[model samples]
Target: MTLDTWTTRLSRSLLVNGLPREYVCRTTREMADHLEDMRDSEGDDDASRRLGDPDTLAQMLTHGFRRQSLFGRHPFLTFWLSPIPIATFLAHIVYLFTIELIMPVVVRLYGESEVAFVSGSLDATKVVLVLAMHLWLQAIPVLLTMRLYRIIASRAARPWTSIIPAMILFLLYFSMTKFELTWPSGTNPGNYRIDIGTVSGFSSQPVTQGLQALFVALVCILWLYRVAGEQSSERESAVTAIP
Candidate 1:
């Protein structure tokens, strides 16, 4: 099949699988083409092999997109180039409940007790560094998503109202998983405790946490709805203005 044909089919496939169609067409199609070319090159020596089988080609293309590490010349590129709206509604719902709700609640319930620590300048510096990492981790995904929205739909530029919700959701997830993973593994001296407990919950009470998280999630959903509306309107206006 021709390159355009393959891209169009693959684009449709991704859409059916719940990715945003326009984005897969614009951002990911080129990568698919490139991977196809690489596979063709590799398969050139095998005269009997069909290099462009659609099923195999699609799998390779999707894998490349997922495994792409945007270091070196394209440092930090994945944040923008990720397949947007990549998850199905069911998958997103599952993620929301497990990562955003259940895990955070579990971590907070079991991990918040006080622990003894040594006092020193080194310890203080370690604490600061860990806190900084947590802050950056929380901020990067939201900031990147906003930046991607601007790049993808430039005409619909507006501050993302979804950030508050994503943040709240992340905090819920963060509180549950952070310390349980970061605590020191042994009685090693001069070590800092990267406790998940340090992450303040949305609220101490589970019910209160859920309510606050829901508010943030509502803000996010509304913002996303507005964004989709603005993009659609912009596209319509452009089409009307076309000669």
Candidate 2:
């Protein structure tokens, strides 16, 4: 192919491989300029030979864009924070509405909490349910964050880095959900009582919510790593299977 044709091919290939349009435009222009400059240094044949074919070059670029270093993964939350994961964010909104529907049933089943719970009030059990549900809502953010990272990480990158967001999200949810306080109730004029407990550690409660969140974060990290690893394996197998 001619130089222009080759550049066009590379540009199209990069676009097809999911690169952003602006990036593709800028990159293709720079590459074309470089090729034009080198056109005189050696014959077109030698230059083409050195640069390789459009298909090969595009594949190499795609590979580089996809791969990320393991250590850089922890602090690489920028992309996760940007672009707004629309699908997953919408899913979380759906989840919010779903909770509105489902929690009433959950409360009705848990205790005589339906009336208070549905009306946007909280007794001890209702409060626990709300907190737990908030924690569950965290799944959306972590799941979306995982997907975003997966797009950038290489197949052989081991998916170990996805653990960071998963763990952080888990701790965030866990800390918010972990509730410790005393509930005062008076059933008779002369008698009063203090009730205390949590959803899990109803007794022997931990004093610090951070400690509980940290433990939960560990669990989240382990689970996320296993899940991401399995998914990466399956994807690789599928790609390999594509003849």
Give the candidate number with the greatest TM-score: 2
Mark the regions of model 1 whose C-alpha exceeds 4 Å error after superposition.
Answer: 1-7, 11-51, 65-67, 70-208, 223-243
Error of 1 at 236 (Å): 14
Residues 1-243 of candidate 2 have per-residue lDDT tens digits of 676667667766665554544555676778777777777765453435657888888778766655554423333553334323443454456466656787677967876565544544336765666556544544444455556555544332323454455345434543443344334346421211111112444234555455555555655666676866775565444333322
* For model 2, the run of ten residues with the poorest summed lDDT: 188-197
Cand. 2 TM to true fold: 0.41
Please state every model's RMSD to the true fold in angstroms.
17.1, 10.5
* lDDT at residue 117 of model 1 (Cα atoms): 23
* Model 2 regions lying over 4 Å from their true place: 1-59, 63-80, 83-95, 110-141, 144-178, 181-208, 235-243
lDDT of each: 0.41, 0.52
What C-alpha lDDT does candidate 2 achieve relative to the native structure? 0.52
Residue pair clashes in candidate 2: none
